[model samples]
Target: MGLSFDYALLNLGRRPTRTVLTAVSSALVAALLVCTAAFVRGLEQSFTGAAQPDVALLLSRVAEGDVLRSSVQAGLGALVRANVPGVAVVSEEVHLACNVTVPGSDGARAAMVRGVTPAAYQVHDAVTLTEGTLPGPGEVLVGRLLARQMRVDPSRLAVGETLVLEGAKHRVSGHFAAPGTAIEAEMWTPLEALRGIARRPDASVVFARLEPGADARALQLFVDRRLDLELSLLTSEQYYADLARYLAPIRALAMAMAALIAGAAFLGGVNTAAAAVQDRIRELATLRALGFSTGALWRSLAQEAVLLGSFGALLGLAAARLFLDGGAVRLAMGAFTLGVDGPALALATVATLALALLGTLPALLRLHRLPIAAALAED
Candidate 1:
């Protein structure tokens, strides 16, 4: 005979404290799993989504993936504009990944400084000035999200504030925003001023916009054939996509840590389940004597574990939604919001259920080994 649904539920209530503790432990594991997965996935999406599909990024052939390390003659922008067909706009840019000390503090934080011209505004149309104006020589425009990325006060990045970069004092001319993109974490300065400060004679990358109806493939091929230029071309979308792949190791580490945490939680749950089953041996043996099949006994216990897991998962997801969702996590590359999207929630659900069933296995094995008469005779 199969146990009634009420019978399974009542079993959990028989030891309410144990049941609550186990569920809470599982909930913590679920929260950790969801947050970790969401953080990595959000970072990947933020980076890959930053690229505009209508533009192409030209990098030095020697530094294909490392834009900060790449250097191409500043004059190359003019050359490309003059020679490359279907190119409507060309913006020369210099990128440097450096650390800057916070104002009035000895603490330092990493920052990406970009040297750009007015043409850059046209190429990256998503950027919009929120305060003050575009940067002029000796001035810089800070991304609206830069303060958050650097984990500093937003007022420190306000217009008129000065930030020392490479030992050069540069006033913050404005604040700009480019939501959901890596650009939101960068600081922009005038091309000439940044070159002088960074002591670089060349630009890091060239951005080119294609005219409507123009063939991106043909433009890429044209750059590829320019052996004298020694340049590599990638669509802006492809560039950010490549950047996401470059940061895969960090994401992998996050996933591994989440797995380790979940494994520990699972072990804790196993111990709880084993103790609960040990206490209920006589009850289970009495059911067996009442014509309950072994499969029915197993199913009843499994149902209880799953029910506990489901409740825990709900609590964990709620906690994550309240605390983690939309929260920004800063990395070496930039800041990405923690996303508790559908996939992350679904994964948490599956992990919770799996842990519930797998964690109960030891208890089930112990049940199978107990002699019916001996189990019922226990005090």
Candidate 2:
């Protein structure tokens, strides 16, 4: 006959301190796994979600992944408009992915600055002005989430405030909102004014909007035919996808670190289980004398390990939801919120159960060789 479920639970209660410590260790490992997965998944979703299929990004061939390093002639937007068919709008902008010191901050922080023309509003229709108006020379507009990205109060970045960038003072003229896009972490200024500040004679990129029924392949072919431009074209979706691919190594590193921690926890659990089995040898021998089979005892021990692991897994999931949910992690591109979704929780649970089973193997093997006579003779 199999060991009773109630008896298996009783075995865990006999050593409360050891059981609790082992469970806590498992919980820590599970939480780490969940947080790492959530962080990477959130970043991927943020980048992929920001892409608009109807827009094409034009960059220098050498700056395919890093827009800040890209520089093309300022007149490229005009040239594309004149040469490419099915082009609805041309939004030319200068991108500066630089570090700036905010007022009351201790050190320099990374920020994205865009030098844009009035036509920029036409192409990026998702951007809506929330306050004030379009910026003129020496003036700038801030994204609604820029304050959050800088880890500052929103009131500090209010309209009429001054933002010092590269030793140049730019007055905040307005605030804009671009929901579900990476632009939410950026600041905008007049093309001529930012060009002077950046000391660049060219724009970093051109964003072209396609008309209805227009395809990006035709635009690519058009750019390919223009040998003089030295330009590369990608759909906005493809651009962000490439950025996600470039940052994949960071995600892999996070997962690898988590796995190492989990492996240590698994070893700890194995030791804890072995000790518990040793301490219970006499009791198990008494049960064997009472007609319980060896298989029944082994099954009971496995159940106890699973029970302990499940408790730890529940605690870890709760901790992840309370702490990691809604937490924002910033990367080189922008910031994305950590998501403790259903899939993350499920993965943590499965990993916890697998660790529990693996941890019991050594104890099970020991039980196979345990002589009922020897165990019963112990003090």
Candidate 3:
């Protein structure tokens, strides 16, 4: 409707190829930002959701005692129960990784094995024993995903099926699913059962639940005062966040890669926009000679750039969605599904607009310094 709109259309019509290329470049950058941001957010949510708000975890300073280790003193569990008031129960955790051969497949895959108390089910609702009964000592409960990979019907993985863990036999007593969480990739066994396999009397970590009205900081202080045990207390929420730190290096690397890719795309898009603008110099000069204001010309150029960016963005987003929806990607320490959330989509849209705006920068600067007489004479 406006003079600027008309001018933009004229320029684009004169150099359709360059305009399209600029748009494509913008779209790619936008898509990468959207996807990377979504990945970081998803990982954060997954880890935080894995732990409960009120629960606390106790670990030795010696091993950086978290779920990753194999040993903590068996007597220490009793000491925490005696000293920490309003403390519910202390559950020992043992972690192991082993290879299992899937039925009908000669290949083997590694899986995580966790040992926890029966109270773990109550302390952490995210962990649900979906079918069959909890594992007795020398028995184990596996996650649904692992069950599927194992090619064993979870319901049919009865108490007597021999499950080999590091060449030792344990019965498959149960199956569980911690939906949308990393725990789904693991199997559970009793704390005592893991002692021998762990080759130590100490469990990996002690998970504690504070009583209602108990001060978390106070409990932590009390535990801190006991210098002999070398223990540290972390609330469940903080614990998971801390654990996520391990993945930070990889996430940062992904972001850096995305940035590099996006930067290349932006540079390419800018070059395209510059080429497109150069081709339309004669037409733009004609408009100015015919009394089109500088502002009008500028707006028109910006609009054209924006359109290209927007179209590119939409195309890129469509590509990402089609390829990533429900697709699984491996992450540091775990794997996650690609989720196309509202924020990610919005980021993509913004990227498209930004690309267009950036593309117009050089053209606007050039136009400001251009000689009207020279521009007109070129035509």
Q: Residue 44's C-alpha lDDT in candidate 3?
A: 66
* lDDT values for all models: 0.85, 0.83, 0.70
Clashes of each: 0, 0, 2
Q: Extract clashing residue pairs from model 3.
A: 72-202, 72-203
**Which one is best on TM-score?**
1
Off by over 4 Å in 3: 4-23, 75-79, 104-108, 128-140, 143-163, 169-181, 196-200, 225-228, 331-333
Using all chains and alpha carbons, the TM-scores for the candidates as numbered come to 0.87, 0.84, 0.82
What would the TM-score be for candidate 2 when compared with the true structure?
Answer: 0.84
Tens-digit lDDT string for candidate 3 (1-379): 3474665666666656666656566666767776786776666656777878778887777656366653557767677778778887767677767665434345555667777887677777688877778888878887755654454454445555766676677778777867556676678888777767767567667777777777577568767798777777778888888877877886798778767766676576567656765777887788778887666777777787777777778887887777765544454235554566777788767756775677667777777777788988884
lDDT minimum window of 10 residues, candidate 3: 326-335
RMSD of each: 2.8, 3.3, 4.0
RMSD of 3: 4.0
Which residue runs does candidate 2 get wrong by more than 4 Å?
A: 117-139, 143-155, 158-160, 172-184, 190-192, 199-201, 211-213, 332-334
Estimate the lDDT of model 3: 0.70
TM-score of candidate 1 versus the correct structure, residues matched by position:
0.87
